[model samples]
Target: VLSFGLAGAASQLLGDMAHRLIPVTDREAASLVRSIRTAPLLFGWRGSTPVDTPALEELLLRVSRLVDDHPEVVAVTLEPVVVAPHGVSVLGA
Candidate 1:
């Protein structure tokens, strides 16, 4: 699972947060982090199943926007994005 801790002053999105960079040092990391915001991934890629990157992106975007807006949130730890053949599920938020 990819985990991170953010340390900064108070801030707010106060607007459309469906598209924004997550807490990251650079754009590449932001892209990677945003990709897995949907569900956890099982131990399968080739023949197992595919994960919903879009759904995860939305979830991550919302969460990231919230965190960005609210300064009170010092940090957050989320479970890895889990993907199932039937659907995707995020263990923790």
Candidate 2:
């Protein structure tokens, strides 16, 4: 379950992102993706295939649960999360 502590606007240039506190729900996870300006890339841009949004949502939810289960975890950052039609891969965490 890879995730991050709030999405950034990608060097503050690409676009904006949505955020919520820990314990995010599935609905919120979906909304987070939608709120991102570059969300279309995830849905399939150009001739690219769309990634599994449900898997992304599940990963977000699981990360939220981890935060809720632990008290010492103050921040988490998983950069370059590669998502494809087949699966997702965390490039760095």
Candidate 3:
């Protein structure tokens, strides 16, 4: 199984995040979404459309698996993963 942890926009000043050791389940992924202080952004705040959180969770899970499968990958970084109502895009990595 994949060994994973928190994967998202986690900053003390901006927002908070949830984390787990590895093999995070669907329930855990949902919980992680709730743990974020800026979670409202994901669920749609004001006139903004809600983001595809499921996609984000899937991405996280996939990344975790990739890391687990590749021991040579000591570290990974995916910055500015843009999420929208329809889909998500990786602006940088």
lDDT of 1: 0.45
Best by TM-score: 2
What's the ranking of the predictions by lDDT, best on top?
Answer: 2, 3, 1
Per-residue alpha-carbon lDDT of candidate 1 for residues 1-93, written as tens digits (9 for 90 to 100): 224222123212222112334443344334654443231232244566655555544555556666777878867656554644455576775
Strongest candidate by lDDT:
2
Once fitted onto the true fold, the runs of candidate 2 whose alpha carbons sit more than 4 angstroms away are 1-11
Give the lowest summed-lDDT range of ten residues in model 1.
7-16
How would you order the candidates by TM-score, starting with the best?
2, 3, 1
Off by over 4 Å in 1: 1-30, 33-44, 85-87
lDDT score, candidate 2? 0.72
* Greater-TM-score candidate between 2 and 3: 2
Prediction RMSDs, each to the true structure: 11.7, 3.6, 3.8
- Let me know the TM-score candidate 1 reaches against the reference structure: 0.47
Local distance difference test scores for all models: 0.45, 0.72, 0.68
Give the Cα-based TM-score of candidate 3 against the true structure.
0.77
